[model samples]
Target: MSLRRRIAAVAAGVLAAPLVSVALPSAPAFAHGYISSPPSRQAQCAAKTVSCGAIQWEPQSVEGPKGLRSCNGGVAHFAELNDNNKGWRVSNVGRTVTFNWVFTARHRTANYEYYVGGQRVANISGNNQQPPATVSHTVTLPSSGRQTVLAIWNIGDTANAFYSCVDVNAG
Candidate 1:
C-alpha cells in the first residue's frame, strides 16, 4: 500500500473505534425489589402517600449489605425511611397477617425474614432459587398494638439484602 493510503486507513480505523464504543449500550442500573402489600415505607414513597426524596423515584432500590436492620438499607439518600416520625400510614390487621413482597428484578434468594419488636417472627426459605413476581409469608403478631415490621430479602448469590419497613396496628 502507498504511504498516503496507509496513513488515511489508520486514521479512519481510530476515528471509527470511538464511534463504535459510543454506540454500544451501557450497563443498566440495579433496581431490584420491595414489599408492596401492607404498603412498605418505599411503597408509600412510590405511591406519593408519603413525600420522600430519590427513593420515591425508585422504590425497588433499597438494597445494601446483608444483616442491615435499616429500612432504607443504610442508603444515605433514603434516610427518610429511617425516621420514626415520618407519618407513615399504618395498616390494621388481625394477629395473623400475611406480608407480601413485590419483586421487579427476580433474583435467587437465600431466605426471607420478618421481624417485629426486635424479634424474628418468620423465616421462609427461598431454596436458593428465583422467586415469582410476588411472594407472601404469614406470621402471627406476638402482641396486639401498633408496631413496625421489618422485612428482609437476603440474596443467595450476593452479600446484599433488600430492606423494607411496614407500620401496622395488629389486633
Candidate 2:
C-alpha cells in the first residue's frame, strides 16, 4: 500500500477503536418515598396546647467513597445517621403525637425502623418494590419536657442510607 494510504488507514483505525470499546455500565437507580397520613397539618398545633406536637422525618443522601460508583455510593447509611446523631427534635409533652416518613429504593427493596427517645416504636420491612415510597407511624408523648424522634432507612444491596426529623411540643 502507498505510505499516505497506510497512514490514513492507521488514523482511521485509531478513531474507530473508541466506537468498538464497550461503555461502562450506568449506576443503579433508587426512589425516594413519602411520609404517610396524619398529615403534617393534623400533627402541627400549638406547642403549648397539644400534649405532643407533630414530628416529620426523612432519609438524607450522602457522599460515598472515591470511584466506588453505585446508585447510593457515598450515600449515607442508617448507622451513619444515628452515629452522627442528626435528626429532628420533638417535645414529648404526654400528648398524642404522630410521625411520618416516605422514601424509595434503587435496585432493591428497603427497610425502615422508627424510634423515640432511644426506644423502638415501629419497624416495617419491604415497604415497596420501587423507588418513591412512603411509610409512617404515631405515638404518644412521654409527658416529658422534650423528646427526640428518629427515623432510619436501609436501601437495597447498595450501602446508601438517609434520615431526617421534626420537633414536637411536649406537654
Candidate 3:
C-alpha cells in the first residue's frame, strides 16, 4: 500500500473508533444501590430473611422517579415491600444509627434522605461524586417507635432515585 493510503486508512480508523463505540450497545448497567445494613426490605429478601419474588435477585435495583415517596420507589412489582408482615425482621437501633448502602454501580448522588412515619428525619447532601462500594450514614432518629425507615438515594444528574425501606425498632 502507498504511504498516503496507509496514513489515510490510519486516520480514518482513528476517527471512526469513537463513532463505533458510540454506535455499539453499551455495557450492562449494573447501576443500582440499596441499603444492606439494618437490612432493608429488599435486603431481607436478598438475605433470605424474608421470602420474596424478583426483588430477591435485584435488591439494589429498587429504583424509581425522584421526589416521590413510595416504599417500592414507584416500582409496582416491589410494592410488596410496603406490605405489613411480621416475618420481616426488625433491627433494634439506637437514637443514632448508621445505614449502609451497597452499590453495584455508582452514580453522582444528589442527596440521601431518611424518612420515618412519613416524616423526613435526616438529609445528607451528596458530593456529586461516584460513591464507593459501600456508603454509610449515621442518622439521628428524632422520634422513637417500631417504625420503618425509608432511605432514598437521589441521583444528582438524573430524574431518578433508589429506595430502601428498613424495618427498625427505635430503642
Candidate 4:
C-alpha cells in the first residue's frame, strides 16, 4: 500500500476502536425483565392501555440498583411509572394474588420480593440460580382496597434488579 493510504487506514481504525468497545458492553448490561401478568405499569405502557414515552417500547428494561422501591427502577425517562395518578388500571382480585414475570435475558437470581403499602409481604428465594423465561409467585393481600404491589427481581450475579408495579383492588 502507498504510505499515505496506509497511514489513513490505520488512523481510521484507531479512532473507531474506542467507540466499538464502549457500545458492545452496554448491550449486555441491560438485564431485561418485568412483571407481565396482571399487567405491571410497564406492561400497561407496552399494551398502550396507558400512554407513555420510551418505556412503551421496552417493557422489560426497568433495571436499577437493588433495593430500590420505584416502579421505574429510578430511571429518569421512566418516571411515568412512578406517577400514581397516571390512570393506571387496577385489577380486581381476591386476597390471593399471583404476580408473573417475563424475562428476555434471564440472569442468576438472588430472590423475588413483593411489597404492598411499602411493606414486604412475600420473598421467594431463587437459590442463586438463573431463572426460566417466566416466573410466578402467589401472595395474599394484607388488606382490602386499592393497592399498588411492587414486585422486584433481585439478580444474583449483579448489583441490579428489575422493578415493576401492579395496581390492584383486592376484595
Candidate 5:
C-alpha cells in the first residue's frame, strides 16, 4: 500500500476502534425495567382490610414465549408480595394507599412509568447510563385494593405487566 494510504488506514482504524469495541456481537436489544407482582403463595388480607403484607421484593428479567418478551437490550423482572390466604376486597368507601415498585435496567436509558387502576403515578427518564445494570425509581400506587399495577417503558413501549391487589390492612 502507498505511504499516504497506509497513514489514512491507520488513522481510520484508530478512530473506529472505540465504536467496534462498544458494539454488541449478537444479542438482541431490548428496553428493561422492574415490575412487582402478587405473591406466589396464598395468604389472607390484613385483619379487617385488604393490605398487602410484608414482601421480599427482588429484581428479575422480563421474559415470555410470545409477545411478552423484554424490549431491546433489556431484561424484565418482578417484585412479589403474597396474600397469605387473605383475600383483597375493594374498599367500599374508596380509600387510597401508596405502594412502591422498584426496578433496574441494562444497556440504553431506562424510561419508566407506573400506573395503577389505569392512572399514571410515577415516572423516570434516562435511568440506566452504565451497562449490566441501572436502578430506576419506585413507582407508587395512588389508590388501594386489587389494582392492576403496570410498569411501562416510555422509550420503547415495553412493559412488565402484573396484577396485584393492595389491602387496606397492610401497613
Candidate 6:
C-alpha cells in the first residue's frame, strides 16, 4: 500500500521472475538420441575421449532439419562434429560394420540409413517403436578405406531425423 512498499514489491517481483521459472514444475526433459557405439564424433566428445566444441555437451542431441546428411545434424553450434580437423577418434572396421544407436527418448522410427563416402550402403526398416537403449545393424560397405559413416535415424511420426558420423579406417 505504501509507496516504498510498492516499489520494493515491484523490484522483488522482477528479481524473482527467473527464480519462479526455475522453481516451477516443468515437464520431464526428453532428449533426442545419437549414436554411441562405434562412437559418433559427437559421442566421442560427449565421452570426453576427445576435446572439442559445444557438441561435447550434447552428443545425444545432434539433430537438425529433417533429411540432413551431415553430422552435427546440420546445426552450426554442433558444426564441430562435421570437422575432420577436430582430431576425431577413428575405429577400424571390416567391410561389415555394426552401428549402434543410443536413444534417450525413443520415437517411432521410420528407418535407419547408412552411408559411406556418400554412397548408401544400407537401408534398414525401422517401422516399429523405438528400439532398445542401443540398436545396432551390421552393414557391408562396398570398399575398404578410411571413411566416414553417416547414419541417419528418421523419425516415423515427425519429419526430423538424427544424424551421426563415425570415422573409421575400413579394412
lDDT of 3 by residue, 1-171 (tens): 999999999999999999999999987567699998988999899988899988999898888998877779888888888887647899999888999999997899889999987899999988887788899999988778788888999998899999999988888
Candidate 2 local Cα displacement, residue 27, angstroms: 9.7
Pairwise lDDT winner, candidates 1 and 6: 1
Q: Where does model 4 exceed 4 Å of error?
A: 1-30
Could you report the Cα RMSD, in angstroms, for every candidate shown?
Answer: 3.9, 10.5, 3.3, 3.8, 11.0, 6.0
TM-score, cand. 1: 0.86
Query: What are the models' TM-scores?
Result: 0.86, 0.43, 0.83, 0.84, 0.34, 0.81
User: Deviation in angstroms for 47 in model 4?
Assistant: 0.5
Candidate 1 lDDT trough over 10 residues, lowest sum: 26-35
lDDT of 5 by residue, 37-149 (tens): 22211122223233433322222233322223122113222222322244444323233333333334443444455555556676667555432343434444555544544
Query: Could you tell me how far off, in angstroms, the CA of residue 111 lies in candidate 6 after the best superposition?
Result: 0.2
Off by over 4 Å in 6: 1-29
lDDT of 6 by residue, 18-94 (tens): 99999999984557788787888888898899897777777788776676778878788877777788788889888
lDDT of 4 by residue, 1-171 (tens): 999999999999999999999888564444589988899999999999999999998999998999999898999999999999999999998889988899999999999999998999999999999999998889998998999999999999999999999999999
Per-residue accuracy of model 2 over 1-171 as CA lDDT, tens digit each: 999999999999999877766455556444444333232211222122223222122222322332332222334332332322333333443466555654444434466555566666666675545443444455654455554444455555656444443455657
Counting only residues 3 or more apart in sequence or on different chains, how many pairs clash (N, Cα, C under 3 Å) in candidate 5? 26
Candidates 3 and 6: which is better by lDDT? 3
Off by over 4 Å in 3: 1-28
Each prediction's number of clashing residue pairs: 0, 29, 0, 0, 26, 0
lDDT, model 2: 0.44
Please give the lDDT score for candidate 1: 0.92
